[model samples]
Target: MKFKNHILVGVLLMVNVFVFAQYGKQKKADILFNKFSFVKAANEYRELIENNYNKDYATRRLADCYAYLRDPRNAARYYKKAVEQVNVPIEYYYSYAQALRGIKDYKNSRIWLERFKDSGGVINANDFEKDVNFITSVFNAKQQYFLDKVRFNSKFSDFGAFEQNGKIYFASSRDEGVSVKRLYGWNEQPFLDVYVADVGTKRNVDHTAKLKGDVNSIYHDGPVTITKDGNTMYFSRNNIDEHGLSKDKKGISNMKIYRATLRDSIWTDIEDLSINHSEYSTQHPALNKDDSKLYFSSDWPGGFGGSDIYVVDIKADGTLGVPTNLGNVVNTKKSEGFPFINNEGTLFFSSDGHPGLGLLDIFGTIQGENDEFVDVINLGIPINSNKDDFSFSMNPNGITGYFASNRTGGRGDDDIYAYHRVPTLQVEGIVSDAINTKPIANSIITLFNDKEEQIAYMVTDENGFYQINIDRNQDYKIVGSQIKYIDDYRTFTSKYLQTELTTITANLLLNPVQDVIKLAELNTIYFDYDKHNIRKDAALELDKIVSLMQNDYPDMVIRIESHTDSRGELSYNDKLSIDRANSTYEYLISKGINPSRITEHEGFGERRLTNGCEDGAKCEEKDHQLNRRTQFIVVKME
Candidate 1:
């Protein structure tokens, strides 16, 4: 009995020691996670979960670690286990939904999202569902962008690409060949520094160097923007002073924006912006088209998300106005940053809150009527993957640009990708007067779809040129109109567009409404040898006249003349011609054309034969058919 008791006590002591060791490890993992050291925390938590120590807590923490690392596969795996527990937090349901979305399992994502809603989640359930469906359809649509990884990407994180003055500026953590290497605990990479490289015509980079200035610091730096004049610049860096970084109560050093001036071809006069707060972050500076405003991302208090985009006006004396939040439209309930405003005033930024393919997708928005950014659209596909994609920058031309992504098949944790969008399918043309061929300035050009719904419109420039982007494989109608000239329309389809031919030119010529009558370019109205009643072919031709007079020239009046082939008797032919003219006029009236537009109807009975098929001349059926015709001549314009 004594020997058995001693063995049991020994077993208990060993189990206690194991439990204490697990407790210590769990504490360490928690500390690392709280400090944002997700890479190391993920390793620690994985071991704990594998050993079945504190399985519930460790599983959820592991899932969170993967989420923070932007690893959706592993995150979904552990989150699946975590939420299976009986008393899991409701927020985990929302997290699982987002993780499922990252893996493109949108059907299951919607299920969990609905569950999250039923469990009292604060998100808009309907909007998220609609966004999922909309984004899925867009992803299934034709791809419009092509991306290539730049050669200068380092083995470490290399991202946040910008371009100015023939050089590409980016942030990187590459420190090869340096005497001493400082590693960040978050991912064990070197501290980020601003780097620049000459950009080739094809966006290729063969060499890179640290930016030439005192702008780089031992801490995180870079992701910059320059003014149009190239004499001023703004960049982001960790909040620091001579005594080292300024930290909040939690010992986290947030980022701050700094302004620098160019002198002697190097950036100097580094000054931190007054808008930064020690308790929050303000980084990722961007300049508007005219340099009158500055945009950036921050985690400032009262923000709708972890980070929200804000804008500030630049006064004439180079001072900044009060910062204003971009509002809930552009800012979501999750992080939104890395703003880049193109010359056309379109705002492009990265967001994780919006329904997307994965972690952080690039979105574009245009200013709405209320001056708020609206119509946010995910860039979709090749620009975004199932990983973190951000820091989008595009030129004013809206085709070529660069973005950063940490997706698979990259050389580093994050890589800069050069992207070129396929040219937008567009139609362009000149509008001119029909008589003198002079360019018609300020003429309205309207575009309609197959449904006859107006989709877009623009006015001709001083050069009488107008261009409009259109969709592929769709039928469209373009109409040119001026006050003094009759409107002209051309219908065309974009079906089977040539791969190399992107632009469709459709010039329009408008006729002036003068004292004399004018004839519209219509297919000839035809009749049978002895028949005068309207035929299917004749009805089709008459519809054109009806449309031109009723829709294009509303106040115009017309006269109709009809004829019959010489094969018929002259008396019968004359009666038949009159019937043909009367039938044409009646069809127009039936189709809603004003009767006043047809002032007279007369029959000529083959008197005006168009060819030598007259009398006894031997001619083919097609030759004689030409003489059986009707003509619509505009009589008066008011």
Candidate 2:
């Protein structure tokens, strides 16, 4: 995500176009827009729109303003009007899709996405359809994080939160000195500086205060990384030295990473890293857990993209070795940088080149079994957006982490967000035979979702203990069945607790079946969405159950109970459910199970819901599907 601020001479050219031809609010707004003062530009454009002046330009500028500001809902609204009035840019379709995604209008996002691709879009549309499918699953497949805005965030660009020992360090561009104001050419805001805060007695951090003296420099200072011992540091700064600001051939000052040592709590002896050069840029340094290697982003020559992550070995004598690119798998033809590696050797970074839900999505890669890094996966939605998200960091505890985003609903242009992963619900206990009260080894423990569809399967350990992961505020059923024992069923719904993680112990004791093992706690039959026809997979399961009953318990009786979820009218559901039950009975008779032996079959309709997902109660498909099911019971003994 690009910040709406002046960064280069190109922006002055954009400003000149607006200044030369236009006047009044439109031109004034354009001036701010060229300078990347989106907040002010949005205000001016909104004023013109309210007064019904320059409708086309006003609407377009407003849309651009909100889009740059990461307010997608507003961007989508204005873009709609702009498109209706004048020609909509092809990139607007991509922006529209991102806005729709941010507000969760995924289906519409797809529609606009197709329009984007059809409008001659290229360079970043690879794997578009595949990513859309993956996104849908991610939206409903249980979120890994719950996020909240951090406390010390200024109304400016505040990000890069890192912690060590009892001190939390970060970078912020809050106001420094108005008397001798200095603004970054790119964003026109105060330059960044590394700040320190004390780790709180209860919370992770307390209050933020800027670094003193040498640590705070005349130029853009920080976004720092420190060694484990905390006496050494690496930070980003402008291209400058004793002779003054260093410039490349184009007269553009580049960024460089500097190393400093902590002497008596003061940072001194600052020197440029060996990788720094006046010819190209290198910044954003991260040290490994053992400090054996230093990784940083560079836009040097021979790189695959404008910027790529490179690593250099930290020699035993505390000097840097030659730099090496992270390779093509992690880098792309487009920019990829801001890398942070956790203790597990997983590399997390932000990139726009990879096909994603939106701009600069955060991605993670783990050390492959046979490779250095592989399995790069997008950290979809909430954690990422169409906006830029970078400078990712994770604490030592692993349950919580921090990152920076320019996405909507933040306190600044770029704000830091604190995220916590939901702890897994572990279902673990012993399984045993009911009559013998002895551990049943190798029993099958199948975990089913609210829809009574199996999601995971496990075998009992030597102690007959079975364990599986589950979720809170959700329904799950666990079934245990040994080779000779009748399957026993236990259903539970986990709840929120004080601790971050929770466990449920369910000791399942299966009943022995000598002659006829009546179908108990087993509901394998399934139907299409609201249809009564049995599917091939359902038939496969039913065929096995029928074959077992006909061969072993020819004289036994069986019962079929069919049910439907609480949707549509009650009368319609009742008829549909009864038809499902009759369909099951007919299918069983087709398999040669005597109709006389199966004397019981009925439809429950929606009279009894497994949960309170009845009509008028808001629910998702999974919750409502829980009520639609089939179960079996023994009616007569052999």
Off by over 4 Å in 2: 1-142, 176-179, 199-208, 432-438, 442-463, 473-638
Candidate 2: pairs in clash: 4-36, 5-36, 6-186, 7-186
* Candidate 2, run of 10 with poorest lDDT: 1-10
Clashes of 1: 0
Best by TM-score: 2
Q: After the best TM-score superposition of candidate 1, give how far the Cα of residue 99 lies from its true spot, in angstroms.
A: 29
lDDT of 1 at 66: 64
The estimated TM-scores of all candidates read: 0.51, 0.53
Off by over 4 Å in 1: 1-141, 201-208, 426-638
Top of the candidates by lDDT: 1
What TM-score does candidate 2 reach? 0.53
Q: lDDT tens string, model 1, 1-638?
A: 22433564466467546655765676677655543345677778888777666566678878876665555787789889988975576878878877787788888878887887889876653646553433233223457778854888878888889888788889988866777888988889999998888775433332237887878899999899999888898999999989998899999999999999989978889997888889999999999899999999999989998899999999999888999999887899999999999866668899999878899999876343344553466788889898999999986555678999999999888999998766446687778767435567789999999999999877875546666768879999999998888999999999887533457778999987654333545567888777777888788777777777777778776668888878767888788888888878778888997654565677888788898888898999998889889887654454
